[model samples]
Target chain A: MSLLVELSNVGRDFDGGRIVAVDGVSLAIEDDETVAIVGRSGSGKSTILNLVCGLDRPTRGEVRFEGRAVNGRAAWAALRASRIGIVFQNFFLLQSLSARENIEVALLGNLGGARQRRVRALELLAHFGLAERATLRPAELSGGERQRLAIARALANRPKLLVADEPTGSLDVQTSQSVMSIIGNAHREFGTAVIVVTHDEDVAALCGRRVEISDGRIRSDNRMTAMPTPAPTLRIR
Target chain B: MTELTLPLRGLISRPLRTLLTVLGIALAVAGFVALTGLTAGVQHSFASGINENGADLVVSQRSAFNLVSSAVPKSLSSGLSAVPNVEAVSGILLNITTADDAANIVMAGWPSDSFLWKDMHLLAGRIPAPGDQWSVILGESIARALDKRVGDTVELQFQPYRIVGIASFSSVLNQNSAIVPLEGLQQLLSREDVFTLYEVRLKRPLDKNDIAVARTRLIAAAQGFEVGDTEQFSSSIRIFDLLRAIAQTISLVVMAMASVAVANTLLMAVNERTFEIGVLAALGWSPRRILRLILIEGVIMSAAGGVIGIILGVLTMEMAAKTNFAAGLIVPYLSGWSIAQALIFVFIAGPLGALYPAWRATRLLPADALRRI
Candidate 1:
């Protein structure tokens, strides 16, 4: 498959070079690839993800999306809106909106009208098996439910790439398993290239390949022996 | 969905804050309407008085800035009448006094047979007779204020006069006034040969050219007199102009304060929803879209406030028109133009208030914002 994201000699420094967040890191993510970036805290896994998502410019070297260099804030913003989707560790669902409305917000900047937006939101919620809780707000939903809703919102625009920054960090073991399976299923069904950053071995084991980061550099890059297939359904009932 | 429901949901989530912000804008807009209305009413009264009376010219003492202070010799009336094209000329004496309170009550003295007196429709009782020295005609407004009826004795400046009639004048100046015989009031004020002003009427359906020629002739014939048509008469009043300026200044200050209140509310919303804004960015909303969202919030709040304020302001003006203080002298007028002006001000102010907040929101990067708790 064609390379979807490519980073060449990318380096990001903070505090006037006093701190090296990500130094001389080069990586390539191909279309429909499910890759996990595993690292301990302060190992720059999140920083690398930011570079790949075009949210941050490398101080030196280049970040390319679809073979074009992510040059400026405008370029990065365009890519994020049309081609890339991100899920946060905290879920980051708008607290004021219901589960359905949160997903609708993603579709708002698109060309469709209100009715089309509503249809898409409902469809996404149904896919996540959270249709019954569509009217409930983020605070009203359980942690696992919130994560699933966040994922649904991220996929609202049918993005080609899905970036999850510790997607299951806030969930319990059983809830984490459910959330990871949902992400895997989305990657499989939508043919979206998935890049998940996590320190947990269980979360890393679910991906087809794993890249380990340590001390602002890639420590190891290896393929998994067996890819863990996502469960068919995660029905809360 | 985002244009209508999403911003509304954001505002509804914080109901109390939205309410307080809307209320602040409402009060400011109401204050703006009421203050301007009072001045507009006063100006309207003067113009309506001269226009409705069908008088072509008002000949007051030269350099006199107000009606109460003007003094023209009664002899000027004869000269004014003799002017070519002059159909009739009438003399009037006016003064301002406090009845029982500080509010000024205009007292006008008109010739018993003059057209000025004829113009006032007597609501009850008869006007003073030609030789009646001790009779007074009360305008409807003054009658209500003094609580006097027909045949009741009203003591004016310690002189008791029998109330012969109660009248209603559409012109605000005459509405809050008490009228008496020209000779009687002249004797009372010890200015028998002098009058406050002269009302000159031209031949019926006179063209503008005819009125202008007559106006010039009257001015040339009467020395130390200012002969002007209704338009000049209304514009020459210094007090009306001053009141309008004061009203404008007050309205501006109130509008500025309301804008500040709106800005404060918008800024708070941005601060509280930083993470949500970040998520929106991550989901594909551009900085411009985020800016529009915040600005729309401000616009919605201001527009809602402006509508409520307009209703309240109209009601307040109506109440003022009925009050003793505004009776005769002023009827608070809220014109369509003024209402439109208030709305336009709010619409502009609302967007201006949102500018800084929207810019601040746009500056929030998704990467940095998501990092914050």
Candidate 2:
């Protein structure tokens, strides 16, 4: 399997080096792998995800994607836009835009025209069982619905890598199961490299691999029994 | 959605604040239009009043501020008429006095035999025969104000004169004046040798060379008097200069207020939307695009205000044009250039007011921007 991302001795500091957020962490994510990062609050799980996704630079080490260094801001932006998709913990949906419009925003530079973007957004909403709620804004939607909308938006551009930070942190246990199932389905169906950062042990159990962090360092890396599921027959329109 | 739609949506989300900002800009724009537009109109009135009479030069006493106080010797008119290229010369005497019940009525005295009298069209009755004593011709507006007609007697400075004719001049400024014979006015005022000013007409088949030569000769011949062509005469009016200064000062104050108001509104908008801006940046919107979004909001506000301001200004100008203040001497003429200037001012003010807010938005770091979320 080819390496999708490699971080070697990565360290990130804040407050003029007064606080170390991520320190001397080395990891590699392989292509088509579903990895979960588990840690306590402020244990640097989110920071590690940011470094790997090129959202932040490591202070004293290197981050490589597809065997090339991710250095310049422009290049990182292009790489993120073309190959990686991000889902925030808080959903980060534009409040003014409807569900369909929020999803279309992700397809802005990737799609050709408004009609094409709208069709793709509707297709994603239908696949996510939110087609009837396409015109509803974030405020009108439930928490689970908003998170699902965020997921749909992240997948709008058909990115190869999905990075979700605490995707089910704010959801109820049942809604969290539904969201994890959707993430698992996306991973298995699209063969997308998935990296989810979370503190929930149950969430970590859903992934095939789990890496636990403590005190800015990886404490353990374990692989659990993966439940093989049938791939989703529905494809992107 | 297009990049510009975000700002539009923001504005729509806060309709009240957007409306107030627009109204503020509207008032500032209206102030600019009213102050400068009316001032320019009055200037236009004075200029057209001087130019319409076909007079090439005006000779007034040295250091004279206006025709009301100018005192050139009446004898100068005859010598001025003899200057080469001079077709005719007329003596005009102006006195500020009460007529009927109105105060500060302009009473002009023109030579009855000169071309000045003939230039004014008689609307009713006939022009007072040359040298007719105690007879006056009322301008159309003065006639309406004094409620006097031909054969009706009007008291001028406690002395009654018969209204022999009702006349109208090409310019509104002149139409506001009541005319009497020059000699009659001098006799009545007890200043026989003094006349307010001299209007010099040049021979036609006239060119720029003839005008220049005539101007030079007239200036040289009138040693104790100031000679000016129509353009210079209009510009020399002290009231016009004062009005222009007043207009300029009001424009500056209003522009400053407008800039502050617009900047404050946009800054508040930026502060309110800090988190959203972060989301946009995280979604791959460039800093330049964020700056453009802010500037476009400011411009939309100013432009809406500008359109409303122009409408309000035009209505105000029309209302002012009907008022009798200064006896209707000030005419509010709305010119095309004034409208264009208002638009230009709003355009410049719009972007200038947004510059700081836009820059501040661009300086927001995406990571820090997410902190608000």
Give the best candidate by TM-score.
1
Candidate 2: tens digits of C-alpha lDDT, residues B231-261: 6766666666787788878887887799888
What local lDDT score does residue A33 receive in model 1, on the 0 to 100 scale? Answer: 84
* Model 2 stretches astray by more than 4 angstroms: A1-20, A24-31, A50-80, A108-116, A126-131, A173-178, A185-191, A223-234, B54-76, B83-85, B94-107, B126-136, B145-164, B183-197, B203-229, B236-239
DockQ of each: 0.63, 0.40
Counting only residues 3 or more apart in sequence or on different chains, how many pairs clash (N, Cα, C under 3 Å) in candidate 2?
Answer: 0
| Winning model by DockQ | 1
Interface RMSD for candidate 2 relative to the native interface: 2.0
Tens digits of lDDT, candidate 1, B1-373? 5687767877898899999999989988888898889788877776676566667888877656665667788777777888988888888887766555634676677887788766679999997888998798887877887888998987765567899999887777676777888787788788888887788888887898998888889889897677897667666666777888898899999999999999999999989888777777777787888899999999999999899888777777778777766666676788898999999989999989988998998887777777766
Cα lDDT of model 1 by residue, A1-237, tens digit: 899999999999988899999999999989878899999999999999988986666788898899988776666777777789899898988887889999888888674788898988988899888899999989999999999999888888878899999999999999998888877777877888899999999899888889999988998988874345778774211
Which stretches of model 1 miss by more than 4 angstroms?
A14-19, A56-61, A225-227, A232-237, B50-56, B60-64, B70-75, B131-134, B157-159, B171-173, B184-194, B205-232
